[model samples]
Target: MTSFSPGRLGLRAKFAVIAVAALLLGGVAVGYTLRSTPEPSTGPAVTSDGPERRTTGPGGPRLMVLSNGVRSSVALRDPAGPREVSSQRCERVYAAADTVACLAPAGALEGPKLLVSDRHARARESVRLTGIPNRLRVSASGRMVSWTVFVGGDSYAGSSFSTRTGILDTEGGLRLDTLEDFRITREGKPYRAADANYWGVTFAADDNRFYATLSTDGHRYLVEGDLAARTVRTLADNVECPSLSPDGDRIAFKQAVDGDPAKGWRPAVLDLATLETSRLAEHRSMDDQPVWLDDRTIAYALQRPDGVNDVWSVPADGSGAARLLVPQANSPAPVA
Candidate 1:
């Protein structure tokens, strides 16, 4: 197994991306069931140490990360005044509307665990997963939670890069282990491809309508998904990891260049109405699905030369320079 790193884009990061591709390739979608895992004793429900303090105020939400790569916490511009959110060490976290979802590996051979908690970082529920978790997301209202993981196997992802993506309806108690069952339409025609894979889900304001990346037959598509209908239709091609803007009009995503995925992808934004795509400020290969800092800016984790991770933000319009937001941060989720 490749070792995972927050700051380095080494074999581990390459395998992570390959695993995501395998996930969409139907490598682990046969008769699998999605269920929550028991809360690990290492998790936090309440702390007798004292009440948690407010880390951010009217300025907006603070950035959430695994502080020191060991403790789950949130911080302002700097890591100072870091407020502990959970005791369990999280590999990734997504927070919105007072809801925080943490994805942490259970063991070297076992799959990861998903911990749902309040804004205060108190545990609410825990879900056992079947793979190493990669991406984590929560809807603006926190009613919809989605996750992507690498499900290793011999049949897919040459290097055991198989992946599995799932969604949990927190309010309705419904779980879709894999989008494999969802009906799909490609190029405006009813399509049925056994190799199809879906991931990187971004919910709309209504939640019922969402967007995600669907890959099949060696091609990737930006798909508009309907939870109610359990259906997804291709909206555009070459887009992966679609993150809807806070205003709901634009999406931050990665676009594969020259129709060659192996060449790597560039960060860009797409307008839903006009279908206009604008490249972001960054020039390096971005393996992340960027998070919108607000309606105007986007933030993502970047690896420094010394293997230290930092959160950097850039204007969504492709006009400004990328600026560092927090040093030593891996997953940068807004406090909203």
Candidate 2:
């Protein structure tokens, strides 16, 4: 009788191989059942390092970007939604109902100007702001808004463009105060401005004090200016892009150590009293603006290597990692 070729398996061998495969698959299933980790417990509320300390509007807030210095924010019923808000071109601050601030050109700029807009990019007020007024700040009540109108066409702006910070009442009255050598606040604590290049003007929760970034002789610092006092004091050093907390106790800013605008920088937090500086996040890319969410978390605009700017958020306490809040964004503002 001819012998069976080695290439063909006998019935017994085939059965053995099948039996081994069955046993192996069964063992894998059993091992997976025994060794797999249990699913994490879900609860009514989850906590984290940052805003567990302050009152937050909604958990897992979503971001919306508009332009270089503008954004719109809305509630996140679901984080995975299409990022569609009920309104068109609203500012990012969502805490107050229908309250958001947009940065627009002040007017037909004979010189530099800042235009303040409502949540929907509608005109709120024009401050005749001159010089390079980049970032504008509005009060918690959204009543008062201010910004630095740098005057220097050249470098002498510290002396020449040294601006007179102005305040406007939506009801009617408009007042523009001269520089520090001469301030124009009738009362309210005697406020003074840092310098001409100083931008990022923001009002306090009480609508009393204002905060901003001042570039003096190329060194960047944070200043808390008292409108009533008519005086300005440097709060923190090596920092710019200052955004105050909703409560008005802490400040979120980007620190520039090299003192050169070309070198780039990182995001930081500073205690208003001690003037102590702490780094919240580092960026190989440019981090443009930061807005506070409940005084503990900061949301800002960041640009990646591919040149797509997006919104991002990280804890103020520096306990958590930097998370991308919006995948596509330019200037991100936190609402309410």
Task: Give the per-residue lDDT of model 1 (tens digit) for 300-319.
Answer: 87776786777678899999
Q: Scored by CA lDDT, what does every candidate get?
A: 0.74, 0.54
lDDT of 2 by residue, 1-336 (tens): 979975788899988999999999999998996564221111122222211111333545544445323233334433222333222222222222233444344445364444455555455554444444444455667666554444554322123444334554443454443424434222234344354345566677766677765555445557667766755666556666678777677788776546555567678788877777777765554445578766678877776777666667788877778876655555555453
* Predicted structure 1, TM vs. truth: 0.77
Candidate 1, overall lDDT?
0.74
lDDT of 2: 0.54
Error of 2 at 65 (Å): 3.2
Off by over 4 Å in 2: 1-64, 67-72, 76-80, 85-99, 105-124, 127-133, 148-167, 175-196
Best lDDT goes to which candidate? 1
